[model samples]
Each structure stands twice: as C-alpha cells, then as structure tokens.
Target chain A: MVSALGIQLGVVGAYLLVALAVGLLAYRLTSRDAEDYYLAGRSIGTVVLLFTTFATLLSAFTFFGGPDLAYRAGPEWILVMGVMDGVLFALLWYVVGYKQWLVGKAHGYVTLGEMLGDRFGSKRLRALVAGISLFWLFPYVMLQQMGAGEAIVGLTNGIVPYWAGAAGITVFMIAYVVIAGLRGVAWTDTLQGLFMLGVVWLAVGWVATAAGGPSALSNALATNKPEFLALGGGLYSPQFIISTAITIAFGVAMFPQINQRFFVAKSGAVLKRSFALWPVLVVLLFVPAFILGTWAAGLGISVPEGANVLPVLLNEYTPVWFAALVVAGAMAAMMSSSDSMLLSGSSYFTRDLYRPFVDASLSDAREAWIARIGVALFATLTFVASLFRPGTLIEVGDTAFGGFAQMALPVIIALYWARTTRSGMFAGIVGGQLFYLAHVFVPAFEIAGITVLGGTYLTWDFALWGMVLSALLTLGVSSLTAAAPEENQSRFSEGLRAD
Target chain B: MTRTSIDYLWIVTFAILVTFAVPWFLWGDSRVFAGLPLWLWWHIGWMVLAAVVFHLFTRRAWDRGIVEGGR
Candidate 1:
C-alpha cells in the first residue's frame, strides 16, 4: 500500500497533464467574450456535445456507487437503477428536451434562469431562479470536490493525505477553468471520459478472471447473498425502491445545469441521440460494476456502513495498477460532474447576479472575467462546505434534488401555467423549499416523537410527497392571486410552444 | 374515438415495456434464463422487457431526428 502511493502520484499526474492539454487546446479557439466563456458561443457540434454530455452525466455516483450498491445489495439494485437511468434519459429525449432545445435556440437562452426570465417576462423571477439553482447545486459541486479528495486518498492509501489531494485537485481545476472555460471543460471531459470507460471495462475483465471466471463468481455470490440474487425481493424495501426510481427519474428534470446542457445541443435530433446512448452506458458500464459488487459480497467485505461494498472489495481483489485506474476513474467521474456544475452554478452568480444586477454596464470581456472569478469563489466555498460531509450520499442527493423540485414550480408556472404571478411563483418556491428542508432537518431537532411541524423528512420514499406539495403550493398560490400580466403570459406561451 | 390521452396511455404502456421493462426481464438470469427462482426471473424479465424496447425506441427516435441547424 505504501509503494502504491508512488503509482497514485504518477497516474493522477498523467491524467492531469492530459486534461490540461485538452484545456490548452480549447483556450486556443476562444476570444474575450462572455458568450464564448460561458456557452462555447452556443455552437458546440453534435459529437462533442454528445460525448461531453455522456461524460458529464456519469459522476462518482454512477461509476463507484453502482458497484458499491451491487456489491452490497445485489443484482436487483443494478437492474432497477440501470434501467431507470436509461429510462430517465429517454424521457428527457422524447418528452421535454427537444422542445427546450428549440426554445433555447430561438431565444439565446444560456441558463435556466434566462429561460425562465424570457418565459415569464420577469427579471426578478429569473434572479430568484438563478438564486435557487445556485443554492441547489452547491452541495452537488462540493460532493465532486469531496470525491476528488476521497479518490486520491483511496488511490494512494494515505500517502498523499486527503487534504493535500483535495487541495491539489482544486488548484488544478481552477487553472483549467481559468484557461479555457466551458470549451476546456468539455474537451478534457471527452478525453477523460473515454479513458475512464476503457479503465472500467478492463477492470471488470480482470476482476472476473481473478474470481475464477464469471460463472463461478456468480455461483459464489448467490450462495452468500442469495437475497441479491433474488432480483426482485430482498433487494430494497418497497418504499426505498419507489423512492429510488422516482427520485432519479423526475429529479433529473429539475437540474438547471443539465437544463443548460440542452442549449449546447445543435438540434432536437442530437437530443434524441444523446438519450439513446444513455441506456448503453448503463448496460455496458454500470452492469459490470454491479457484477463486481456481487463478487465482493461473496468475500464478506465491509465498507463504510452507509457506503456500498466496492471499496472494501476493490482493496481486497484488484491489482495495484487496476486500483490506480479505478481510483482515476472515480476521480474522473467527480471532476466531470463538478467542473460542469461549478461552471454553471457560477454562471448564475455572474450572469444573473453580477452582470445583470450588480454591474449592468460591464463589457463582454469584463463579464467573462467575472465568470472566471465566480468559478474560483464557488469552488472555494464548495470545498469548504464539503468538510461537513452531509449524512449519506443519498441524503445530500435528496436535498439537492428537492431544491430543484422547489424551483420546478416556477419553471412549470412560467412555461405552461399562465395564471401564475411572480408573487405566487416566488411564494410557492419559498413555501416548497422551506417545507422540504423542514422535513429533512426538523426531525433531528425534534423533541420526543413530535416533528417540528409534526412532519417527517419524507425520508427515503417521501421525496415524491415533497415534490407534490411544492407543485400544489405553486398552483394554489397562483390561482388565488391575480392573473399574470398579459405580456408575460404571451411570452411564456410563445416560449413554451403550447400549441 | 381518437383519444390522444388514451393513445398516449397505450404509447406509455409500450413505452414502459420498451423503456424499462423488457431488458430487465430478459437479462435477470444466467445465460438466457437458466437456473433461477420463478419470481426472480419474473422480476428480471420485467426489467429487461421494459429496458430493451426502451433502448430500441430511443435509438429509433435519435435516428429519426435532425440535430443540426442553419440549413
């Protein structure tokens, strides 16, 4: 393990060098403008867009957590989670994404806030949304940085130290962000993604071989964790299953950063193509992780109680070189998710907050610089916030996911529901977000059996209940208020294309 | 009676099959349905059946769309 530290520095250094080269290449193509800095001037081609989106979407959760869950739970979790991811993207393709892409193109909408602003004829609401988006996304961004640190430590096994690894990764990230902005992030993401994907396949093959081949491993796993083998039952309580499925499915719809990615798509067709690739990733990549998980279970390996089983299993089974690759892959996933998110979240801060509200007279070049500055600040805060790692990854997931659902009220109200007032939308958002947080945090502070408002955190399964309350609040508030101003309704309908 | 919602319902059901149901069913066992409990196979069957059709439909839709602009 001590010697493995040498490999860690070498591999991580190599990957960082490759990543920086991609950033430098991207920097060569841009000029000093906010548009270029933020959205690649809204002109990314289909292939780069597709690959980058693919790379961006598969974070540490999918890469590491999939195997972890599988190792702990069984085949059923993998089957459901994998299928749900594909299903989620497909729905994104068919139902909402294309239309959003079209509307975004028509209006030069770069951020979800911009989309809401245009749709609602209310800059204040846009700012509100921008605020919500930033708040919702911060923890997610922090998690990525946190993962980068964790992967470094895991990959090195305390040789590098978690703090040093985290700080080193963050410094590298800031340098990348300053050099190329979105272009650099997207380009490096593509190369990193391909590298990580290759590493996953090789690791799977190697592990399968070491375990006396796939058949024997499967047989062994079944004897040990027959519940996992059961597929349907013994996998998860029914409530957790529904929660898992719904949270992933609808929860995806609310992410503003993902929403922003839609605009970079060249057309609706690319949107569909992207969705098509989503399932294949699950089958090819995630399934193997789950299989690895199954293999780990047979060994009776222990992990962080809340963590899935792969870390312990990986430590036990895989070769050092492969471990480095797995570490690199996990780190890559974190970098991919965080870089894009940090960039987007900071866009809201700079674009909606500073550019429009703080300094309307700023030049395009100045705007670009401010955006770069925002990235630095956001990263620093996210890194700091991560020191207080929230409960389980799932709890953090719910908070972020629920935050977006709170904004879903404004999104739907602005686009489809015309009767919504800014006051109503704003009120609904506040009510929903507060209610969700209360449900999440209040129980811990509760005295005896009574919750603060006599409500629950909507724990694993009750996320849907939170979403429903948010939507209902938005709708009810809007109805009780006066109709939205006439022009806002027109712009919203036009933007929504509610023919 | 031409009902869009009803049409959508059928579409959704087919969607459920293609999107998340089929692949789950077909792939849940060892090498094309060997040696697994009856209920286990049923669960896998549902997942594969839903998932495979979903994959095909997704690809088909992607193949059908024109992703570029400024023609």
Candidate 2:
C-alpha cells in the first residue's frame, strides 16, 4: 500500500507533469515572431483571455494570503479584496484597459514603456518607466517563489527543503516561458486557473462539512471571536478598508503582467466580456478562501503562522489525497503568476530597455531570443532572492502593490490627458517613488514629540499618499511644461475621443 | 460613440453600489444569519448586484469610441 506522504507527493508531481505537458503543447502551436511569442499574436479569445487574466491576477496572495488574513483579522478582508477590489478593478479594466487596447492596436506597441515612449517621443522616459516597473516587479515575482517554497515545505512537512521547492518552481517556469512565451503561459494559466478554482471550492466544502457545516462554523465564530462577525473595529477600520481597496485596485491596473494583458485580447468584444466577468470570478475564488480562513479561527484551529493556516487546516480536516490536491492548486496559483510575470518582465527588458537603449537596430528574431534569455536570468535571480525569505507574503506583496500604485496616475494621465509631457511623467514617477520609499525606509518623523510622516497616518496607508503625490506632480508639472507636439498627442487622443 | 443618458445612469449606479459596499452601516451589529454575520450577507447581496450591473453595462454601454474607432 502507498504511504500517505507518497500519495500526496504523487498528486503534486502528477500536477507538475501535466502543467509541463500543456506548456510543451503550446510551444508547438506558437510561431517564432516577437508578437506571437510575447502577446500570443494579440489573438486570444474571450475564454482564454478571461482565465489567463484571472489566473495571473489571483496569485498566492488569494490562495494563501486571503485565507491568512481572514484567519487573523476576520471576514472584513472580504470587504477589502472581494467586494471592493473585484468591482473596482473591473471598472478600471473598462476605463483604462479599453483605451490602452485601442492605442496599443494602433501603434503596435508591446510594452507600456513603448507606448508611453512613443507618445512623448522620449527614450529616456521609456527606460525610466521600464526601470521602475522592473524594480517593483522583482519583489512581486520573488513573492511567488517564496510562496511556492513555503507551500511545498508546508505540504511535505519539511521533506522538501525551502530552497529546493523554490528552485523547483523557478526551473519549471523558466523552462516553459523560454519554450513558448505568452502562448504557453496563457494556455497553462487557463488549466491552472481551472484547477485552482475547483480544488479551493472542494477544500472549502470538505472542511466545512467536517466542521459541521456553515451554521456550526458561524456559531463557533460567534462564541469565540464575535468581532469578526462585524466591521469597523481594530484592523477593519473604515479608513483601512477604503485605503486598501483603492491602493490595490489602482496597483493592479499598473501591474506589468496585468497591463500587458490589456493589449492581448483579440477584439473589443473579448475585452468587454472578460472585464464584465472578472468580478464574478474574483468573488468565486476569494469568498471561499476567506470564509474558510474565518471559520478556522472559530474552529480553534492552530497554525504556526498565518500563512500556514490553510495548509495546516487542510491536513487536519481533509483526506491526504485531497490535501495534496489543494496544495497543488496553491502551487498552480504561484506558478501561473510567476510565469506570467517572468514573461512580461522579459518583454519589458527586451523591447523597452535593451532594444531601444542598447541596440536600436536589433532584428525581431534576435529580440525574441534575447527576451527568452532575459526570462531565464530573471527567474534565476529571483529564485536566489527567494532563498532569503525577506518578509511575510502579505507584507512583501503589499509593498510591491504600493510601488506599482505610484505609476497608475502617470499612466492614466498619459492615456487621456493630451497635455501630459515626458518631463511631467518623469517627475511624477520619480517623485512618487522617492516619497513612498522615504515613508517605507525612514523612521517616523517627530518634531519635539509631534508625530509626522511614516506609518499609517490617521489610518490611511502610505500608498494612498503616494498616489496623491504622483497625481499632483503629474498634473502640476504637465501644466508648467510644454505639451508634446499636437500630432503626437493626437496619436492617442484622436482615436480615444468620443464622437 | 457618443455619451448617452444610459452611460450617466450606470456611472451613478456603480458609484452608489461601491459606496454602500463597505459595511459602515452595520457597525456594532453582530447579528448572524444562516451562520454568517449580517454584514457578510450584505456583501453577498451587494456583490451579486454589482455583477448584474456589470453585465448590464457591458450590454448597454461597454463600446465607446475605442471599439468603433479601432475597427
């Protein structure tokens, strides 16, 4: 008879093999052109686009962090991630993504830097945007690796060391990304997305039933921790909820992986349909994870740390095979996110940073090859960084989100506002980043015992302030600076203006 | 491509939905219904309403200048 550990490992191994097979199959279908490799030839249909975007956006954060937060803080996490960001991000998809698709289609742009650079006629600005995106993206990519490591270690009870687990995913993702690029990433994302959804719901049902269903779970919570049943107390303050919601929504809009997706849908109809369904998909995944986490608290389940709550709870309540399947689902979430980030990061380096700055005359085939190399190097570097285990998954993820949130103002201004100049964009991007860093790195300011900047001021997160500063700089600087040439402005504005 | 009354209506509708999504109104109320808090039930209904609004928006107003202009 097979041992429980063997069965668990077998399920995870089988999942990885299937993922690799899917990636290789996509490699066969992919063409050699840069566009085809990077953006799937901009021909992704509604279903693939929806699932890929869904999978790419909902990472270890949703699978692990969401449950962890609910376990500690309560169900108010549902307010922050589920109800608020779900609808808000979908709105942004329409407000910002639609316009981006139009502009990208018209210009044949592949990266955000390329689009912004062309609009303002500034190569330096393009490089700046690429640099900042890469800087923030690095931590987020490492977040996935760290999550994979911890998750694998959690499932195997230390049989698989953290470094090996991180390395395993990094190697697998790099192999597939280099093999088929966005085509493989998207196809695999669809499969992994489906796998994650099904497994998470199953885990929720099994655990809930074992705990005597939702009513019993709620009774447990009501008796043990009643604050979780209400709102506006402790960590679930009104300001905390609103600020987190805004920051995450805007930050998601600027994620390089997600932003690149705006240009990948085959038609406007596909884009519309995808955004329309995004909120519902988000709800379906987030609610179950958060509810389970909240229920864990009531059930008096103990975990080493918040991040370990889901895995520990599953082991205690569910069957061994089911636990392994859920762990694989969590791995699916991590790999789906990491692969997309690596693929998009490569596009940024090759198209925006290297080609324009290093070798302006590089051939398309050579550029594609360079991007593959970049993915390998990038994945390897982040894998090594993941070994350090810098911060908790939520802390590291929040920092990256805030960093990217600084870019949203400049992007929106560049897209809709005609007067947006290259210098203004630079000032906003750099100034906001510096200020945010000051808040992050510097100790709280005090003048003779009076508190100032650093940490949440009056309950608002530093990210909200960073975004406000970014917008002010962008608008203030653009007003004083000369506008880009009217013809250049018209490239975006002419097509986007309502008739 | 032109802005319509329907577009304005959706903008207002979504704005209201977002405003009420936060359970400030339910502060200090710990009533549990069906083994869940009243606030949780509020969010469940709110999300369902939001999804419906989104579907309606896509049918009625999703295509603006971008779609037609791209084609």
Full-model lDDT, candidate 2: 0.79
Question: Model 2: per-residue lDDT, tens digit, A1-499?
Answer: 2487798779887887777777777666654433464644677778878887888656876677777788888988888886446788888898788888878887788788888888888888889888989989988888888877777766766666778778878887776776555446777777788888888898888998998988999888988987888776768777888888888888888888889888877788898778767767877888887888888899898775323578768888998888888877678667867888877887888878998779989997888788788878888888888888878777788888888889998889878788887778888999999988888777887988766666676668888988999999999998999875532777677654321
Sort candidate 1 into its docking category: incorrect
Q: What is the clash count of model 2?
A: 0
Across residues A189-244, which tens digit of lDDT does each residue of candidate 1 receive? 66777777787677767777777776676577667765655545554654555566
Superposing all C-alpha atoms, what RMSD in Å does each candidate have to the true structure? 4.6, 2.8
Clashing pairs in 2: none
Question: Which candidate ranks first by TM-score, i.e. highest?
Answer: 2
